[model samples]
Target: MAVMTETEPPPPPPIRGRTLYRLRVLRHDPTALLGLVLVVVLAYLVVAPLVAVLSDAFRLQYGDEAHAGQAPGEWTGYYLWRVFRSPVSRLLFWEPLLNTLVVAAGTTLFALVLGGGMAWLVTRTDVPGRRWLAGALVVPYMLPSWTFSLAWLSLFKNERAGGQVGFLEAQGVRTPDWLAYGALPIIVTLGLHYYPFVLLLVGNALRRIDAQLEDSARILGAPRRTVVRRIVVPLMLPALSSAVLLVIGRVLGTFGTPYVLGLPADYRVLSTGLFQSIRDRSTGVASVLATVIVIIGVLVVFMDMRLMREHRRFVTVGGKGAMDRLGRLRRLRRPAFALALLVFVVSVLVPVLTLLLSTITRTPLDLSTFTLDYWLAERLPGAVGFPHGVLRGHELWEAAWNSLRVVGLASVVCAVAGLLVGYVVVRGTAPRVAGFLRQVSFLPYLVPGIAFAAASLSLFAVARGPVPALYGTTFLLILVMAVTHLPYSSRSGIAAMTQLGREPEEAAQVAGASWWQRMRRIIFPIQKGALVTGIVLPFVSGLKELSIVVMLATTGTQLLTTLSIGLVDYGYTQLANAVVLMIALLSFTMTTLTQRLTRTSLASGIGG
Candidate 1:
């Protein structure tokens, strides 16, 4: 072969102008640019409202300022002093704070015990009816967590006339305040509903655990208790801690259950206190309460982070050799089955049966009082506003349709935005932009729902740039629902994307495929299951979301949640129960339909 001359390549083109260079970079690094844009938009939507609320904490609000002889726009600590230092602070803040802690801790412990036990029974033992128990245990979570409290009220509400007095009181049974209201009811109701969080987490961990580790421990002559203490507990801590964190966060923000259960006894959590302050137009006090809640939520997050950091060395199921060996419960299997079934009955069956029965009966437990007026009667002269039966009336149907439309649009938007966020955070090159986007997207989760609602009202009640005044608009509800529920979809997208190998996209990129083209043809198709889940979860959740919708929905923009709350407010107990039952049924139907259509488990989407 003839030797070739060693020639250097020609010199590169001269450097371009800054603007053109940036344009070129935008074209090439589309994901990075997209991530930057997402950060800005999310900051405007999430961070800006939160900042406005925080500022309200230090600023003089109208009512407080008026009372304090200060100008409306002036800054004052009058509200802060009243909340923390004044004599009334004990009644206004400290007592509520103590009650909140008690309820939260009690709910967490109850959920953990019940859920952890069920997880063990389902994942480890050869219990009869394991398949049925696995599903039935999670059914309560599909219902609004406060559905339990509502059912509890239907069965146990006492000391009030009319519909507020429960079936027990109507039957001349004296239901004690301790059982009928306050911390006990709140804990039990919230526990029954929230236990599924723990169940999913712990069950997933148990299922993924390597049986070989336990076997090795047994082979070394370690006792079962010793094996569990030394090996299993450490392995399961992540799931346990995750379950605890979720429960804690939920309790901090959960308004409905406590509000429904605690109201009779004048019990108040921070969420209800904030809601009350808002209702009374105590903007300064509301702001202070909201600030305290956010600070608590942040503290919880930091504690969770520190706990996770300490457990960094304890990774479970690293390779392919994991074997989920079922334990031989033998004679105890039937007992375990009974125990699991009992929990399902107590948590899911009871509340649902109560709601269903209450809806069908004019009065609870009196067969003679059974009537179809609530469901299908064309006219009920005794009824107010909704003088027709629920099914025959315009209100329920309209509200249901509104719920479906608004939540559907929101879910779709949430899914698409979630995908974009995941793409940027996982696939983009700009680490800081990705980090900011992730944090901002999740910021809404920490903020109390009512606080966010109050913030949304404050921020969007007026025209801002291209966004018009949205306070009484359905678009506002859709926007808030999409943003508030975005965490579910975004987390789902991130989880799916993290597992996805980038080789397909890299190959497409080498073939001169555009970013959108790759995302459309490859990423979207690959993660469609996750996208569907992202959409469905939010839809189901937003359907029964009372706090946010209650604060936002007006007469013309009534959603199912708002409609149900209205019925409750009007003392239409049967009508409200019927509406709540419809909500539960719809949520269950949607979840089942999604699973049937996509062949993906909702639990897998959450736990994965």
Candidate 2:
């Protein structure tokens, strides 16, 4: 009678029937269980830490209770006031905010123009060394970003930070503050480091555009400029805008280049500001600054999503047989080639040679000061703890081993987890679960490395319920690295999974194969290349990763990146340069091997 009424609820199903229904669903789609598990795990790993950081910003930290006029864990707006409205706001927040915006804007513009030009030159023009140049330009990105900053200092440093003078300064040239450190140098160094983002994104997009669209416009009496403006530029906007956002996001979170170049002149961006707060043990201030960075990064991510949605409207509807042709440079070919060569020289050759030169020379660009003390010597005259050469020292070897062990394990974990996440996203029966898995896995991509590290430290450094405190542990380092870099591998997995059919797994299932069996035999073999890429790429990234590990690394967990940074902080310039060059060499070697094995370049694999 109750069921007969429209407003009344239906009778509850029998317990046996409910059990049978769930069993059938589970049997038919086992990924539903996997998806549910992944959702819960990722929610805790990804969302909980962010919530902790936000909570910490409002809560009075232990020592700040006196100033905050509240209990340690109680809520207070004192941090917000201190960061934004207090007397020290200019140094703590306002100046850094302004500097951040300027450097971000300037770096974005510089990377766009330089990277966009190179993309067009190689992908659309008949340049002499298009193939070679295309591969060479991405090399700058492979090296640690701070490599350029170190090289810049080697070439142009004055006696500002109170160590040794740079090559130009040694040669009787005075490098001014603006040129040597602060916003200008930050912009140039970060731009050089990040331009490859634009090149890869815009280059791929340009390659996909139909040449027929431009030809059609030209035939309709459109001038060359008109054709480019109307047909080419509009189609390229999505990629161009995406590149802009990518560069901006990077500029917002980047610490090494800005810190290395900006610190001497007392210049601070939001990233460096956050680092200082953390270093000074100002937990509330660090949380507030990190929150601001996370908010800006989230805005960028939302803008990217909106732009991606708008991208659907600009699709080119054409037949499968699309014509593609490169424009001939003709009389300007040599000049164009020279210009491209110069970019490679400045971006790659100069920085690397400078770093290498710095490692062996007491004074940069001074051949007379050359020595193997930095690399092979057992002892140095005036050096303190780091007396031995980089190779001969136990510290360098220990750090290198730690880098390999931690990052290597993290990469493997990321690859496997990413593959499973892709499986759930692409093949699961439950739409909501799949969507949740997809979004949560990708959320870390929007977070800057340093902010995420701070968040991870906040949440996981202390034990929660059954989990143990992870602070200062190698496992924590591995976990944070894996989570931060998961986006790259997960994206690769999703793309690869979309192309894979369930038929193989379905057939295997019919043979009474378990889910693990199907995945192990059928899915794993088919997607091995993607798995390897997910591993090697993260490994390469982790090798050069300073921002994330620097936030978390302790003495026992010294990675090559943190070790190099430590040497820099101790004013061991040559030792630092040597470590940096080794990191670059190791990263480059891994990337090269991965490219040959997987047939995927580092630039192409990223954000694709």
Tell me, by TM-score, which candidate is best.
Answer: 2
Candidate 1: which stretches are off by over 4 Å? 1-33, 161-164, 211-228, 316-323, 464-467, 495-523, 602-608
Top candidate when judged by lDDT against the true structure = 2
Tell me the tens digit of each residue's lDDT in model 1 across 1-608.
Answer: 99989999988655676678878767755887788788888988888877877777778876565567788877887888989999889878999899989988999999999999998888787888776777778888899777898789889988652455788887999999999989999999999989999998888878878888888889999999999999999988877987898788788888888777787678998888888887788878888888888888877877777777976677655443444568889999888888888898899888888888887787774668888877988887678677877898588888998999999999999999998898888988878988887888888877767768877776787787887888889899988989998887888888888999989998998898877788889999999988888888888888878878777898999988778777766777778888889999999999888778778664562222
Worst 10 residues of 1 by lDDT: 599-608
As for candidate 1, its clashing pairs are: none
* Model 2 misplaced stretches (Cα beyond 4 Å): 1-30, 317-323, 602-608
What is candidate 1's CA lDDT for residue 167? 85
RMSD of each candidate relative to the true structure: 4.4, 3.8
TM-score, cand. 1:
0.90
TM-score of each: 0.90, 0.93
